[model samples]
Target: MSAVMISRKVRKWEKLPGKNTFCCDGRVMMARQKGVFYLTLFLIIGTCALFFGFECPYLAVHLSAAIPVFAAVLFLFVMAMLLRTSFSDPGVLPRALPEEATFIEMEIEAANGNVPSGQRPPPRIRNIEINNQIVKLKYCYTCKIFRPPRASHCSICDNCVDRFDHHCPWVGNCVGKRNYRYFYLFTLSLSLLTIYIFTFDIVHVVMRSVEDGFLSALKETPGTVLEVLVCFFTLWSVVGLTGFHTYLISLNQTTNEDIKGSWSGKNRVQNPYSHKNIFKNCCEVLCGPAYPSVLDRRGLMHEDSPVSASSAAPSSSSSSLSFSNNSKPAPPTTKTTAPLIPNEHTPDDAKASIGVSAEQSCSPEDLPPSFIPPLASPETDAEASVAKDNSH
Candidate 1:
C-alpha cells in the first residue's frame, strides 16, 4: 500500500464573535424553555381536570379513566425527553462552518502496492457543490485540519461535526455523533405519548357523556361542546404529528435534517439511512444487532482518542496528534513505529488527529477580543498622572 496525499482548501469565514457559540447556547436555552412549557402545560391541565371533575356528577368516572391515560402519556413524554437528551451531542468533533469552509481533496498514491484487501475502489472524486456554489474551503482553526465530506460546523460547540446532523433545541443539545440514538428514541417516544393522550382523552370524553344520560348530555352540559372540540383538535394534531414523524423514522432521517431539503450533499443520494426495511431496522435499533456504531454514539469531546469508522477507508490506521499551531497537543501521542498503514487498512494519522486537534483548537482566546475580559483600568497616583500629562 502507498501513502495517499490528501490536501484541503479552506476559505476564510466571517469572524463574528457571538455567532460561533450562539447555536450551542441557543440549544441549551431552547431545551430549558421547552421544559418550562411542558411543566406549565402539565400544571394547567391537571388543575383544569380537577376543577371540572369535581363539578360534574359523571366527573369521577372521567377522572378515573384519565388516570391510566395520564400515566401512559407521562411515561411516553418522559421517555421522549430522555431520548432527546441522550441523542443531543456536545459538539466535540471537527466540522465545517459556512464562513470557515474547507474542502478535503484526497489523492491516493499507492506505494509498491496493489489495491489493499477489503479496500473497495476509492470513491471517485467529484466536484461537490452546495447551493450552486463551487466550494472553496479552508482549514478550520478549531478542527486544526480540513473538513471531511458531509461535515458541518456546530456553532454551539464551536467545532465541526461529521455527517452533519442538526442541533436539537428541544434537548438543549446537538444531535451529532454521541447522542443521535437518544434523539431518535426521543422522537419515537414523543410520538407515542401524543397518540396515547389523544386516544385517552377521546375515551374519557365518551365515558362522561355516557354516564351523564347520553341522549341529553350535549344539551345539558354547555361545556361539552368546548371539551369535545378541544379533544378533537388535539386528536387532529396528534395524527398529523405521528404521521409525519413515522415517515421520517422509516427513512432514518431527523426532523432538522429533513426540513432542509435537496441541499445537503448526503441527502441528495438515495438516503442510505432510509433504505432498510422498517421492522428489521426497528428491531436492530432497539434490541437487535443493528445498533448505531460506536462512532455514532459519542460527541467529539467525549470520544476516546483515535477515531474509527466501520466503513472508513481500509488504509485508515490509529494515530494520535500531539500538537497544533493553536494549542498544545495531547501527551503520549503515539508514534508511527509500526508501518504507517496497518494491515487493517486503517489511517493512524486521521484517527489520532481527529481527536487531538479538534479538542484543543477551541480555545477561549479563539473568541473575539470583545469577549475577553478587559483588564482593570491601569491606576495612577495624582502626582504620576500630572507628571505624565506635563511630559506629554
Candidate 2:
C-alpha cells in the first residue's frame, strides 16, 4: 500500500505542468549567455587600450605618459571587484535536519485532528511577532523550507538567497547579502573610471583645439571623439546605478523589497532591521555589523530555540486545512454496502442529494456550516413524494 501510494505521488508529480529539473550548471551557462559580463569586460579593455595608448598620445603629447598608467590601475580595481562579486557565495540555506522531520510529523498530526481543538495551531500565513513587531515570512516550496525576511528565490540562480538584492546581469551573478558590498564597490569604481576617462578625452580635445585649429584637431583626433561618446553613454548607466544603490544603502532596503512594495507605509515602521538613521543604515550595509546567523520558525534573527514549519505543526496544519477548505470540496468515500437510490435525477435533485449526503457524512462542528446546504422544504419534499407515487 505504501509503495503504491509513493508511486501514485511520483506519477502525479511527473504529470505536473511547467515542472522543470533545476540544474546548477545549466543555470550558470544560461546566466553567462544572458548577462553582458563578457561584452562589458571586452568594452572596458578595448576602449581603455585604444583611448589611453593610441588616442591620448596623439591628442595630449605631454600628458600621454601618465594617462595609460592611471587608466590601467582604475580598470584593474574595477575588474577585481567584479570578479569578487561574481565568485562569492550568496548565503544559501543549509539542508533540512532531522529535527525538521519532527516538526513535519506534528503538523500532520494537528491537521489529522489528533490534537485538541483548543490547542489547534495558529495559521501559518498569519504574521509572527519579531522584535515586538509583526512580520510575514514566506515559505519556499522549492527549498522545502521557510525563507528569512528579505530572502528571496532568484529564478536565474535557482536558489533562495539571503537578503536578496537583485540578479545583476552585468556582474553575471545574484547581488545578495554576502556579495552586495563588492557589487556596490564595482559599480562605484566603474562609474568613477568612466568619468575619469570622459574627463581625459574632453581635456585632450580641448587642448588639441587650442594648440591646433578646431577643425584640424577634430580631423586628427577622431578616436578622442569616439572615446568621449562611449564614456558619456556608459557613465550615465553606471553612475545612476551607483547613486540608486547609495540611496538603498541609506534606507537599508534591497532592490527586491523596494520593487515589491514590501517596505511601504505602515510596514516601514514595523521593519526591525531599519534604524531610521541614514548614517547608521549606510554603516550597517557598507561597514557591516553582520546579521545574526540563527533564526526561529518565524524567520526572525535570534539565538533562541530552533523552530521550523514542522516545529509549530498545529499552526502549519491549521493553515493547510484552511487553504484546503477554501480551495476544494471534501473527500469522496467508498463503501461495500450500497444504499437505495432513485434511477433519475434532475439538476436540482442531484445537487440536493449530494448536499444531503455531504451533510450526513461531515459534521457541522467538523467543517463550516456553509459547506452543508439546508434541507429541502416540506413543499418540495411533498412534490418529490407525489411524483414518485405517480411514477409507481
The C-alpha TM-scores of every prediction are 0.40, 0.59
Superposed model 2: Cα runs more than 4 Å off: 1-35, 55-61, 64-66, 95-128, 265-269, 289-392
Alpha-carbon RMSD, each predicted model: 27.7, 22.0
Taken over the whole model, the C-alpha lDDT of each candidate is 0.48, 0.68
lDDT for model 1 comes to 0.48
The Cα error of candidate 2 at residue 316, in Å, is 51
Query: What range of 10 consecutive residues in model 1 has the weakest lDDT sum?
Result: 317-326
lDDT (Cα, tens digit) per residue for candidate 2, span 53-82: 656565456765677677778899999998
| Colliding pairs, model 2 | 103-310, 103-311, 104-310, 121-314
The stretch of ten residues in a row with the least summed lDDT in candidate 2 is 1-10
